[model samples]
Target: MRPFYCLTFICLSFAAAAQGVDPAITERPPSAAQLPGVDAPPGPAPRPTPPAARPSPAPSAESSSPLPDKDPASRVERLDALFADLKRASTSATADRTVDKIQAEWAASGSATADLMLIWAGEAVTDKRNGAAFDFLDQAILMKPDFAEAWNRRATLNYIASDYGKSLADIERTLQLEPRHFGALMGLGAILEATDRKAQALEAYVRVLEIYPTLKGAQDAVGRLSEELAGQRI
Candidate 1:
């Protein structure tokens, strides 16, 4: 969710090898429902890490100052328009562009300092120092408490560490700030599935599909959960 400042953003690959983190910990199903026509390959899982000991900060614990000194009303208006367009996009290409633009805006903290913290957090993740990455991201959130990307990335780190409870907590924060975050919604679905909350997971995936119809992961999850639930009912 961290905006790609200088054209560099968090890989979001979920399972990049360089990070020694398995994407599966984030969502570990045999990916099938192909993206368009091609099957999306599974990324390697990273070595298992224990959950963090400390409790996650409450959703209300974010720094009091959640915005930059300069008002970002115009940017908010632009993003809202793009989101509206995304919802109505008739073509895949148009939807893709709209998604990209929306995500870019979501990543921007409008503060260089906060952005740098995000970059550092990413680097920590790459180095396989997830604990360190969490610290960096916590600071980022403190500096820009309203930055959804910071909460999103931190949630990702908790997911990677297999701390589902913490991950879910942070995810709640992310969604609170950005309800339209399909990525967080997908993540919520994965965590729900992993925790044996199948019905909730299905609902989460369904929501993601409603937002981004072409998202292959959500498609696959929805199919899998639907089949599982149907078999149970039968």
Candidate 2:
């Protein structure tokens, strides 16, 4: 089986009332794994939006340039070091830099073509070109089934256009490749919360916090869920 590595970089976003688009199809999306069809809470589903760019397309082979390989041994060592720095960071500002460094490490797929396709797919998603994005991502995954980022990305698109089952499948594949993927875990948590699996959702968020304690979003989710769950048990 192909081994992949995924980071839990996604979360459920309850789009603020002010965040709506004009009555037209446009924009990006997010994650979760409490598969669909559960008694999920009544709310907008999580969507798949492109993550922050790692420099920036399905791109032509001729146009692609060689990228440095993320040699597993070296990259893992670096990530371990970075995670340590991230947790020790005293401020969000300081931790943010470490967070970016870790994600940059995670984004490298060794294959320039796959990277290009991922960039193209992100652009397509941003431009409301879901079909194009799908094509780009599909080609990327075909080319690199071991690409954890690719699987995580497809999971986002699957949830947006298809169903939770398909998205979760991709997510699980990502985790299979990289169990430390906090981003995938965040996606799982969000989906669980949406699907009315509050206990499971809390567990997921706690897992994320274990990886990145400075993440305010996870802290917020944990706090919110704790109160809600406590009330239920009361």
Which candidate has the top score in lDDT?
A: 1
- List candidate 1 segments past 4 Å from native: 1-70, 90-93
The true-versus-predicted C-alpha distance at residue 105 of model 2, in Å, is 1.4
Candidate 1, pairs of clashing residues = 3-107, 21-46, 22-45, 22-46
Per-residue lDDT for 156-207 in model 1, tens only? 6676677877877777887788776766777677667777888888887777
Look at candidate 1 and tell me the lDDT of residue 94: 70
lDDT per residue (tens digit) for residues 95-177 in model 2: 66775566556556767777666666655555566677677778878988897777776766666663667777887887787
- Give the Cα error of residue 42 in candidate 2, in Å: 38
Query: If candidate 2 were superposed on the true structure by all CA atoms, what would the RMSD be?
Result: 12.0
Worst 10 residues of 1 by lDDT: 30-39
